[model samples]
Target: MSGTFSALNAATTALWAQRRALDVAGQNIANVNTEGYSRQRADMQAIGGSAVPAFYSTSDGIGGGVSVEQVTRIRDAFLEGRGHTEHANYARLSTEAGALEQVETAFREPGDQGIQSLLADVWDGWEAVTNGPDTDATRAQVLQQMEALVGGLHFASASLKAQWNQTRENLTVLVDDVNAAAASIADLNQAIQRGNQTSLPVNSLVDQRDLLVMKLADQAGASVRHGKDGMVDVIVGGVTLVGGTSATKLAVAGSLDLAGTGTSPVRVVTAVGGHTVRPDGTAAGQLAAMNGIFPSYQSDLDALAKDFADAVNGVHTTGAYDKLGNPGIDVFESADGSPINASNIRVAFDDPALIAASGLPGAANTDSSKADEIAQLRSKAGGPDATYRRLVVQLGVEAAVANRGVQIQQVITTQIDASRESVAGVNLDEEMTNMLSYQHAYAAAGRLVSTIDEMLDVLINRTGRVGL
Candidate 1:
């Protein structure tokens, strides 16, 4: 009787174990299409051996039941962290390339009506003025071409500089996102640690934390470490970024000195919620944009402005009777005594007196030399129009390259994500198979229970008694 009951108990345990397995399989199937769902697996262990009568135990040992251990989500923290870093690098390169492209577009060089063409036309006008020195029409044509030359410069310079500033502003917004991501990562990290201590599955927190790390990396590159104590540590350039479950926020700070002369790199301090974080690699997309594009574009603009001023002044000083016939007055004067920026260039020539007086000869007081000065303007600075044309072409090329970079990165990121999903993602077909296997095992256990009852029924009624 005891042996029969023991068989029944063993069957019951097998049934319970299979039922649990079926439930878990059902859960996997239900969540198969869920985004960010890590595949779960159940751990099984055997219960301790059962006790039996001494005589029966001597002949055969009792079997132990199955026990459920842990159900864990399958994932690798290392791969997740690496995905984040790569995302940041991709973003950085793409952004820098984008801003540079915009800067390049400002100049439509080598075109028929570009700055180079304007210079040629202006020179042509000067030659005509040279032949007809007293024609009002010739002088007027010279003035019109001069305005065209300045107008193009104004348009190109202003457009490029504005684009540059816009990119910088975009960096500020990306930094805010970075800070918020970091904070959320830290919070999730702490929650996960606590959950681990209490023997609870940190599934939801892990998902949230991993997502944030990916986002943070996209904004700024940082590597993540999942510590044994259940805390997450983030590092950048080998410095502790988020110290063991504690978040450090990042922000965009510091004006572009455009004049910093230090090798230590004038850092843009990133502060968060009133707390400051030590800045790391400008490797992330937004920081890279700020680091590379703005400096180069601003320098180029400065160079162009200075060269424009010098070239015009050089030609004016060489020709006689080009000044407004006034003995001591110079042609151009800024309140700041510097060459005009994109903002101030148009304003610099707001007065026609400045434009009319910008001729040769300190006190010529004669329009006769205007034709001679126009002739000289071409001879002196006319050939250098190629320089401006080259600048515009470079901008267009850079923009094209940037666009290519973005496309390449998009492909790369997609491939990596697909690879990762293959390992960690749940599949409904597999889960359904597991459910069926467990369900069959459960039915087998039920059959054992039915068989045990039938044996007992036979013994109780048929074996003991027809006479009663």
Candidate 2:
């Protein structure tokens, strides 16, 4: 009687166990396409195996129904580390590409009518002045050409300054986002570590933390480590930021003035709990761009300006017309709106008629000397044009190299993620197969119960009636 009862209990347990398996399979299938969700599975074991009575006192015994041991997610830590590493590399290259793009915009070499063309036209104007010397209208034409040339220089210089300024502004904005990401990651690390210490599964928190880490790496490079207690620690550029359940706060100071010298130089400060931590190369990506590229371009512009003015003023000061145009006089102003050289200019005409009639030599000197000066000005413009053109070519090369780096990292990361899915991600086709198997087993358990009931009915009624 006890044996018969055990069979009924075992079959019942089998039905429940198979249902649990089916439920787990259904969950996996439903979440297959879900982002950041790892595949879940049920671990099974035989129930009452140790307590099952041995037949004939031998070791062999009737197996009891199954019991679920535990549920778990399939995950690999090494792969996650690799993914984050590649993400940071991609980010660095992306930043460089953007800065290069801005440089390309400033110069726009090889365009329909870029600085190179403008410089050529200036040369042609100078040649005309040189051939026909004493025509006032011709010299006036030369002055107009000089004015046009100056206009072009001012435009290009202002445009480059604006681009550089915008880069700094953008860096200030992205630093906020980077700090946010780091904070979330640190908080999640604390929650996960707590859960692990208490022997509770922190699956969801772990997932969230992993996602945040990925985002952080995309903003900057980080070195991630896992402590023995299942907590995460992150370091960047030799500065330790997050350690287990504790986090170091990050602050970025954005203070690069438009002139390229910092009214205040931008800096990154790190603090753990209340203690200050050392700051290092933590400023990556566009932040690095603002700190690095934009300033470089600004310096280049200043150099170009100084060179252009020096070359033009050098030739202009060497000669004079009927009215005086002496050396070491004001020729160009700095970008800050300051005059180049003040207080050295004076009219050299002795005759009141010449002084009154000519007004100024460089004002529109029709003398043959003015034509020679115009020719010299043409040379000055050409130097800067050549220099800027060289810079354009270098920028192009940088862009191509940086772009290639981004593409390579992207491809590698995508392939690695796919491989991870193959091992840990859920598949609906496999789940459906599991569903069918569990359903069939459940039906078999129900049939066993029905068979036992029918046997009981025959024994109680039909056998007894034959005796009567």
Best by the lDDT measure: 2
TM-score of each: 0.78, 0.78
What digit string (tens of lDDT, one per residue) describes model 1 on residues 8-119?
8878888888888787777777778777777777777766553545753642365666767777777766567556755765777676776665655565555765666766
How far off is model 2, as Cα RMSD? 5.7
Q: How many angstroms is residue 156 displaced in model 1 relative to the true structure, after the best TM-score fit?
A: 4.0
lDDT of 2 at 420: 76
> Which regions in candidate 2 have their CA more than 4 angstroms from the true location?
51-60, 131-161, 190-201, 228-230, 258-265, 271-283, 320-330, 335-382, 448-468
Worst 10-residue lDDT window, candidate 1: 258-267
Residue 297, model 1: lDDT of: 59
Would you list the C-alpha lDDT of every candidate in the order shown? Answer: 0.62, 0.63
